[model samples]
Target: MASVDLATSYAALILADDGIEITADKILALTEAASVEVEPIWASLLAKALEGKDVKELLSNIGSGGGGAPAAAASAAGGAAAAAAEAPKEEEKKKEEEKEESDEDMGFGLFD
Candidate 1:
């Protein structure tokens, strides 16, 4: 589980650095190509959690601001909870988008 989580995060970082939109399929492909076993649910969950947000900006702020250890930990926990709450809605939207893209890529299902 931890390896899968780390794989997704690394994939996301690489995508962001390359100026690519982070998507579940892309993350999964990366993990799979590397022979990492990642749960689809986890990849999709992360994709949703990161939706509509600037990955670089989000990651850059992770340890920039200074605060007391307790306060910092508290804020981090709160932020994580909020992200979890928002992910479900984004997940639905992402699934719809992925379906549309898949259909478009099929090109009349010539080979499928």
Candidate 2:
């Protein structure tokens, strides 16, 4: 299994390095030429995942955690899921804003 994964990954990298579009056919051809048996689905999934993505740039930026990898930080600060879940409820947001404005007008939050 590990050999199959390595063969497919190397094949994809080779295609990317040569500026050739990576496809399941190309990957399978490379693996077959190298005498490695790989599942077609693995190659297809890899191709789809890498579609429209710059492979070299992706490799270069592997250390940058700018995507959805900050789950722990988001959860620690506050529930990121909760904040996003609230965005769809406009009425709740409006009511909260109205309450805040009214409280401010009553001088309840001025000193605080």
Candidate 3:
């Protein structure tokens, strides 16, 4: 079952590598020529997803966590990091409030 999926994927990649347009028919033909039986739907889905997209650029961006332009992604990541840093401060405030509630439950406040 997995082999069939992999075969279709490989066929699409091969077409992309060779600078050929990937399509459902081409994928199906490649898989058939390689003696690997793959479902038609898989090929169609892969082809649809890759249509009008740069395969090489997509491959190069595999290591990047973001999908847009590199500079935009970098700025977004920086903003995310800043937000993450501020998150701990909010969590600390929550913890302090919880501790105060627990202390009141014990019939004592810090000053008393």
lDDT by residue (tens digit), candidate 2, 1-112: 8998899899999999999999999999999999998889998998898889989998999987665545555576687765764565777889889988999888779569
> Stretches of candidate 1 above 4 Å error?
66-112
Off by over 4 Å in 2: 66-112
lDDT of 3: 0.87
Candidate 1 achieves a global lDDT of: 0.85
- By summed lDDT, the worst window of 10 consecutive residues in model 2 runs over 65-74
TM-scores of the models, in the order given = 0.56, 0.56, 0.59
What's model 1's TM-score?
A: 0.56
For residues 1-112, what per-residue lDDT tens digits would candidate 3 score against the true structure? 8898889889988999999999999999999999998888989999999999988889887888753455565477897766665776899999999988999999888799
Candidate 1: give the clashing pairs.
Answer: none
Better of 2 and 3 by lDDT: 3
Tens-digit lDDT string for candidate 1 (16-84) = 999998899999999999899898898899999999999999888898566455455656889775566
lDDT of each: 0.85, 0.87, 0.87
In lDDT terms, which candidate is top? 3
